[model samples]
Target: MTVLNGKGVLDGIAIGKIVFYQRKGQEAVKRHVENTEEELRRYQDAKEQEAADLKKLYEKALHEAGEKSAKIFEIHQMILEDIDFCDAITDTIKSERVNAEYAVKKACDTYIQTISAIDDPYLKERAADIRDISQKLIGILTNSESDTFTSEEPVIIAADDLTPSETVQLDKSKILAFITINGSVNSHTAILARSMNIPAVVAVGEELGLKYNGNNAIVDGASGRIYIAPDAETVRLFSERREAKKAEQEQLHSLKGKKSVTMDGKEINIYANIGRPEDVEAVLRNDAEGIGLFRSEFLYLGRETYPTEEEQFQAYRSVAENMQGKQVIIRTLDIGADKQADYFEMPKEANPAMGCRAIRICLTRQDIFKTQLRALYRASAFGNIAIMFPMIISVGEVRAIKQIIHAVQLELSGEGAAYNPETKLGIMVETPAAALISDELAKEVDFFSIGTNDLTQYTLAIDRQNPSLEHFYDAHHKAVLTLIRITAENAHKNGIFVGICGELGADLSLTETFLRMGIDELSVSAPCVLPLRKKVMETRMDR
Candidate 1:
């Protein structure tokens, strides 16, 4: 028996025979070609075909894994159509006088190397995207098709690493779980695994490889361990755990439609955070009281240009209408930092986390900000919708945002568009500055939603995206909790509600602390709504 440790990005357990997934393309051999134009034409044709393939994958992913997970394919499509990326392949073909396959391989390798060299882990993971598209293109050029799992029953899949495209292409029904020798929790592949509710462990190293194919394995995602050829006792224990996990999930369904209130009658609103309108289904299925954080930036990502007013309105309206009068708090575009769109043409920042992002971008580019505000207000008539600004630091920023909102309101009225003038306004208390001045800032907005992900990073002066610094990135640091408590206190004093909308909001251990802090709401991922509700109901205050 072998026990291999890794980082588990999802929680679950799987027991099955292990199958090493072999990626489908053959190595592209360097070959000289006489007609450069012909080679370039081949590359273009293959690129277009790959783009179409990605579109299909996008549609499939949308149906299977919601919009957030499906957006990876759209990003891949954008990457495929990127002018710089296309020019690289074409330039290599013309300058090197090489076959299309060889030119593509070289161009992809160069780009991958360049991206991998970046100190930023998020950008570093993007190298896998380039490699994914290149592999598909080369396979098309070489008349090779990607492989699919053909096992009669579900089996655990092991791979060195999986690209977003490759991960989506997998047959979910045939996969019991998947383990990768190399990956990150922030990687798109890991995100997909979590969205699909599949057990996944990453960064397991190369020791568990092809040699162990067909071996019985137990993947304990909660423990980040893979037991290869597990002994009888280990298998028995895992089987019991798996059954208990399944029963627990089934039991959570009973919590649906129940109010997220404490036994001591301290009621708190439990909301869900979403990326797009299509995610509303999950929000509703989980029976969240409302949406505390609607990440509006996703609508701008994976595209070549800004989403127009009508496009933005339709999306916001869809979610608002679907919620059926449930409160939906939409955070304005929080672009920059880890979440980036090349079309924005944002300048490179030495430290983008503290750089121009969220409210900063909207303020600098009022045209963009106003367009979104108009859409949000117009959509407000459909159902309950509120606008929240992120990464705010001062009272001046809030005043400026309100002024812009006033202008949007006047314009909508003049244009005879039906909109709710009573729409609530809120700010994300994500920075220390905002927390310190929560008293003054609370007077400017209708509510405060603490974005603890950035709060913790900024407070600790740590990069949350860096896996190496996971030990130092303490979400429960006294400073962070104090900030939250301060923000909550100031917000309540100023007659405004405060809630958490970051990853920390879902931490069950902090539920009691938050309840004790007089937190009015807790918004987390859809899957967390019920569990959190259960915890809230079972919780008793030590008064």
Candidate 2:
């Protein structure tokens, strides 16, 4: 029996035979083509055929899945027809006098190398898309059949990683779960698996590839472990656990539409943290009261350039309108540290976590800040929209942000644009400095949402992302708890409300403590809303 550990992105249990999926290696031959024009024509013809095939896949996916899942094929089609991609192939053909297949491979490798070198995990995963499209084009040019997986029964798929296109083309009924040697929780494969309610474990390490194919495997997604040919006793234990989990899920689902009020009649708001407009659907499905933290940087990440003000407005407006009057707190760009945008032209700081990021970037680059402010104000007209600034540490930052909002409102008024003049403003109390002076800062904003993730890291003086420091990174440390207590007390004293919108907020063990601390709300991931709500309803606080 073999047990492998990995990071689980979704929760579930699956017992099935292992199915190893290997991408067929495509070798590009450097054969000289006398007719260069003929090679270009072949490239064009291959693109046309690939587009047609993708269109059919898109329609089929749309019928089986929703529009969001089907959008993967649409992105593939766009990539195949991208002018830069086409130019690279033609340029290679003209310069190297090679066959269409070789030129396409060369062009794809250049882009794949470039994208793979990026520091951001989300953008780095996009390299897989380039490779997937390149293989399709090569298959068409060489008259080779595209690879497909056909399973007689449901199986746990094991791969190095899966591209968005590859994931969409999967036979959902035959997929028990997915285990990948290389992938991030933010990868497209993980996102698709979550939407499909499938268990997935990624970054299982290269040692997992050594497991024999077709081995009877049990995947425990909740614990991020996989057992291969487990003992009879282990299997029985996991089977019972799985059944118990199913029961828990049913109970949680029944809690939907129920108010999150404690036994003592203390009301607590349960909200969701979303990164994109599409995530609002999950938020609604989880019956969250509102969106607590909308990471607006998602629109800026994985893109070639900054999103225009109009584009930002449309995205914000969509989330606002769909919420149907529920409050949506959108955090301005929190891009630096672990989340890096190449186009932002940010310098390579040794300690980016404490360096210029978040509100610092917006404050320095008012042009970019003003553009986002303009969009937020414009979208406020749609519904209850609130703006929140992240990584704030002082009264000066809050005042500057208010000034920018004031200027944006004036600009909108001058243009005769409709906007809500009463949009609420808030700030994230992450730093210890912010917590110490919460009373003074609370007077500047409407509410306070403690970002416990950064607060714990900052207070403990540990890098949360460093696995070596995992032992020292304690989210429930007394220092962190004291900071939260102080922040909440000050905010309440200043006639403002306080909530937690971090990973710590979803911790069931700390939920009672937060309630006792007078926390007004808990904003967690959509999946945690029902479970958190259940905890809230069962909680009691003594006066």
Candidate 3:
């Protein structure tokens, strides 16, 4: 029997378990992970074989149909090959002699502990991804069973949290809605659901709280709402609405292959904000104008030490090559609050966010910074490359950083390094002081990117993590908006471009506001590219 709780906007509903993650037997955990990993490799081999066979079938189908070529699968596979890490994780689990669940939990805890020691807020967010992946590998080893879907019935699965891997485990045709007692909006579980286009609700209190064996519910993922055992008419309405939304999404898909310009001819740059190099494909699919906010922290996080220059160069070069001649803005290594770069020998600061981060860290750690700069410059020879400095608050600091950039340029030039000298230099206006002094700083930097997230938090003196103060940290607040306006004004006055590389840039509701402020670019997540592009194409700037 399940004890269900009907929280506001969420109706407690009964759910049945279709699949489950378990704590594999201690000794068997190692064997289980090994077997699963081997199974995956075998599956890959099988896929390769099947794909070859299917290729002939696909060619036949296309030739017979005499229609435009239809892809059986994506052109380039964005293989998230964390196999080495996974193997290492399995080894650690076996050596630690911990239970499967505990080993998985420990890996997540270790990642948290490591990342919690960094000062860069951006890198810190990645810890969430780490935890999500940890949960995934654990589930893979323990939850040998998988969820299956048939038209017969829609089942509800209960879990502490749904990971990207766990979500992928569900039978797409049969799995209806999943409820998790854990996981927040920031968790990758939610992101996975969004990508999979499934209806899921997280933080549903508890598994037992759901009515067991006798109840049904619907999950409204878009609004993060849930419907309990509704009457027939209500269910019908929801079903109809879902179908309508699906149709609408299909319509939205038509906007692809179109330019992201407003009706009134206001050109808003719809760029992709990517993390992994593999995510670059989404940019091309979404027809993103360029890459904005390319988080380089991924190259360092979860590593024993910093990536060598060649390692960094290859990673950077991948984006430049994939972009195929589009602009790509790469921010220097931003490892601080919530980000622990293990091999960097960085001491844990009392307040990492305000401590050594972004340009500050680059200044203090010249060896790492120059390597990155060298990589960036070298990659610049490949395409349109722009380097952005984060958390810069002073004109003096920007000038000092410029000197360092020049120094690197000189050294690389002397070494006959293959690089670009014309790479643009930009600064992130995250600190209030930076925004306030933008008029003066704009003259020094080539461009200005307002990092509205931090700027909002700092300008209002609010800790964003604290729910109580969230109301005060509104990016649209008059003060924050004024600052953005002032900063953009300053940049325009100095004949420098201004763009926003924050969540505000992607907020469709705030697109008008950004356009009103004369923002030059709007960088957003890859998945959001099309909708944002469509939004921009629909909107008109009243300039």
Question: Highest TM-score among the candidates is held by which one?
Answer: 1
lDDT of 1 by residue, 1-543 (tens): 999999998989999999988866576999989999898889888988887898788877776776668878877887897889888888888888999998888888998888777786767766888888888999999989787667889999999988877788888899999899999888889989998889999999988778999999999898899999999999999999989988998899999888888898889999999887877888999999999999897778766799999999999999998999999999999898877788899997998888888888999999999999999999999999999999889999999988998999999999999999999999999899999999999999899999998899999999876665777788999999999999999999999999999988899999999999989999998888999999999999856
lDDT of 2 by residue, 1-543 (tens): 899999897889998888998766666788998899999999999998888887777665544444445556756765786789999999989988999999999888899888778665545656767787888889889887666899999999999888766777888899999999998776666767876779999999887874568899899888899999888998999889889988999999999999999989999999998877887888999999999999898677555699999999999999999999999999999988766666898987999999999999999999999999999999999999999999999999999988888888899999999999988899999999999999899999999999998999999999875544556678889999999999999999999889999889999999989998999989998888999999988888864
TM-score of each: 0.89, 0.73, 0.71
State the lDDT at 146 in candidate 2: 65
Estimate the Cα RMSD of every predicted model relative to the unseen true structure.
3.2, 6.6, 10.3
Return the clash pairs for model 1, or none. Answer: none
lDDT of each: 0.89, 0.87, 0.67
For lDDT, the strongest prediction is 1
Q: Report residue 543 deviation for candidate 2 (angstroms).
A: 9.3
After superposition, which runs of candidate 1 have C-alpha atoms over 4 Å from their true positions?
1-9, 44-91, 107-130, 181-188, 202-212, 224-236
Among all windows of 10 consecutive residues in model 1, the one with the lowest summed lDDT is: 59-68
lDDT-superior candidate, 1 or 2: 1
What is the Cα-based lDDT of residue 263 in candidate 2? Answer: 87
What is the Cα-based TM-score of model 1? Answer: 0.89
In model 2, what are the clashing residue pairs, if there are any? none
